[model samples]
Target: MHILFLHSNYPAQFGEIAANLVAQHGDRCTFVNERVSGDQQGVKCVTYRPASGATKQTHFCAATFENQIWRSHAAAESVAQLFRSNGALAHDRPDLIVAHSGFVSALFLKEVLPEVPVVGYFEYFYHRYNSDFDFRSDLPPQSELSAMRLQARNAMLLLDLHHCEAGYCPTDFQREQIPAEYQPKLQTIFDGINTDFWKRDASLSESHATQRMVAGVTIQPYEKVVTYVSRGFESMRGSDQFLKVADQVCKKRSDVRVIVVGEDRIAYGGDARFTDGKTFRQWVIDNNDLDLSRIHFVGRVSREELIRVFSVSDAHLYWTVPFVLSWSMLNAMSCSCPVIASNTAPVQEMVRNGQNGLLVDFFDIERWVECVLQTLESPPETQRMGSNARQTIEQNYCLTSCLDKMRSLYQNVRMR
Candidate 1:
């Protein structure tokens, strides 16, 4: 089979699945993106750049939609070139096209390959209230323009939803965010975790007395490690709340050390505007009286080092607003790390409170500290939750199972 994958970024959500198809199924794959870097074996890369984007004169509400249209136009032209005499279509064309719906890259693909079945990977649907936009009450109240922009942001997504033959969301929580009329067109399928690589290392148990090193940080035999991973230090992931909880926990328990992973920049928007010329990390540190020595901010480490961090973790802390779920939480759980995550819709879908892992209200710093302490003070119960966490991933979110489901989706769509 031949598959053409489309995204603004190269080898993103489709990377592992594309590689799997090439290695195991002997399928040929081609990826189209605006910025193409990195190499994936048995897969071809094509680049596209927009001729122009929204200008300063453009209305704020329509600026995002305008940029998306330009992206769609650019992506369409790139794909059209692939079908020319000097391109891959000189002999054969793709059997199917799978695209990330975030940027609407596949919006105009039908103009290039009208007969091909296009599958959209819908990540999230924006809402003015009861979603990420309005979830943070601590931040300043959103203006009417913010609500208008939020509605306009979905223009391209709605078009792509109607254009594609089929679509999928990583979780049911994400799928439910879309318009009710289009709900039937989408299915839930996670971009699975590699449980084999993330499985527990029995040697790193808290009962061991040996000192260990992870990502250049030394872990003493008597110390307890609490792990937190995020793409950025932003309010979307509750980085500030995590720090507050960590500070109180460290104050109460001298043996506890917090290992934070990720960069200092805000990956998601809206938090930076309120930070008064300082990065969100610096702003949080400036306002709060946090114990800097006890918390180690080890900026972004490799997967191997991350696994080591999780393996030694007494409790993995994950907190987020009601938004798209972070893969790090699942990865930590896959490593058999006892997790204490936000009791939000997305986290609740994966974690059964007190069964697989503990859950606390997102705003309750005391509850978060209590949960973290519970994991540290009671080793046997924590170990049981860790074991169940790994079981949850293996049964529902293993890479093999998800790949099979993806393949089934492809075949079914092709038959339409």
Candidate 2:
């Protein structure tokens, strides 16, 4: 079988699936994206660039939609050129196409490969109210123009939703956000975690405390470690709340240390608007009375180093609004790290309070501090929760199980 994968970034949601197909099933795979920067062994890589994007004069609400249309046109032309280079042969065409729906990369593919079945990976469907935009009360009220832009953002997504033969959402929380008419065509399947690589190293915890160091940060013999991971330090992931909680916990307990992993930028949300000419990380530091010496901001580290960090942590803090769940949280769980997460819809789907891990209301900073302290003081309970956390991932979100489902979906869609 020949499969063609499409996404704005290479080897994102499609990486493991493509690799599995080639290594296990002896399938030929090709990946097309705007940027190709990863190890593409056993797969062909193609890159495309938009001819033009929306100009400054373009209406604010339609700017995103305009850029997506240009991207769709560019991607379609790239695939057409690939076929022409192959002498336009029927067998050269792929048996199926898997695309990420957010960028509408496959919107115009039907014109070139009309008979091929395309499966869309729908990540999120935005809403002006009752979603990420309005979830935080600290932010200013949404303007009419902002609401219009949120609605316009879905224009291309809606187009791809109807154009594809089938689609999938990484979680049920994300799937339920789509319009009711299109829900039946979508499946909820998580981009699985590689438990084999992410599992905890028991030796790390038993090592001499003075010799314990990960990603250049050392752990003292008398201190307890708390870990927080995200792609960015932004309010969408509750970076501010986490810092505030960290300050209180550190103040209450002299033996606690915090390790934050991620860059100091806003990955989501309009947090910059409130930062007053400062990065959100700096803004939070300016406003809070935090213990700078105790908190270690290790920007980003390799996966192996991250696993080591999780192995030594007494608690892992994860907080978010009602938005797309972060893979870092699941990875920590896979490492058997005791997680204390926000009680939002997406987090609730994975964490069962007091069973697998603990849950706290997003705004309840006191409760967050309490949970951290609880994990540190009760070593037996914390270890039990960590063990259960690993079991949860192996049962539902393991990489092998998810790849099997993906292969089944591909075969089913092709038959149709």
Q: Please report the candidate that would top TM-score against the real structure.
A: 2
Per-residue alpha-carbon lDDT of candidate 2 for residues 144-174, written as tens digits (9 for 90 to 100): 7888899999998998899899989999999
Candidate 2 has which clashing residue pairs, if any? none
Model 1 lDDT tens row, 250-344: 99999988899999999986776778888899999999998878899999999888988898898999988989899999999999989999999
lDDT of each: 0.88, 0.90
Q: What stretches of model 1 exceed 4 Å from their correct place?
A: 37-39, 87-91, 203-207
The list of candidate 2 runs beyond 4 A from truth reads: 37-39
TM-score of each: 0.96, 0.97
> How high a TM-score does candidate 1 get?
0.96
